[model samples]
Target: MQEPTLLILTALADEPRHGYGLIQEIEAISAGRYRMRTGTLYGALDRLLSQQLIAVEREEVVDGRARRFYTLTGQGRAALAAEAERLRSVAAEAERRLHVLRPGLQGGAA
Candidate 1:
């Protein structure tokens, strides 16, 4: 539901990724707007894991460091879908209100 959680879920929607990979994908998805730190990222990952929203797909040792790949579970996918729909609804409402408040705002030059 939160922005970080949404971004994390959305990032995993495409494919499984480790911590660094998730960070890159999330930054890409957000157009470099949200750069997550290591601490924040792992905290969210741990919470998501505890909530059963995501699961570890595999773990590999690279350069003597363990990299854990995570994937979205079925429930995670469902939750993401629901959140997307909710966002669409909210955006639509905002657009409609803006159209009313500022005439010619919709489908016209600002």
Candidate 2:
């Protein structure tokens, strides 16, 4: 999965969120490195919804406006778990290779 998709799934894994809430959470998750635009976020959300990876958990009325909250489906959780494991495995392999290449490297750093 793409980083944005992975980040979205990871964010929703904790709790359902509305669009603005999702944007805020994702920014926090990326440590402000990622600032998602409204159109991009909605596009990703639409794709995920159509793929059945995420579902509308609920809708709320905030200031007389409806806000949809999205949550990860069972399949989404499984996919996220798999992706996280894959990332960990790749990182470990990269570290191993780095150590082999640089004998004096300490814990994956020169």
Candidate 2 Cα outliers beyond 4 Å, as residue runs:
101-110
* lDDT by candidate, in order shown: 0.95, 0.92
Tens-digit lDDT track of model 1 for 5-106: 999999999899999999999999999999999999999999999999999999999899999999999999999999999999999999997668455565
Q: lDDT tens string, model 2, 42-70?
A: 99999999999999999989989889999
Itemize residue pairs with steric clashes in candidate 1. Answer: none
TM-score of 2: 0.87
Quote model 1's TM-score: 0.84
TM-scores for the candidates: 0.84, 0.87
Candidate 2 shows a clash count of: 0
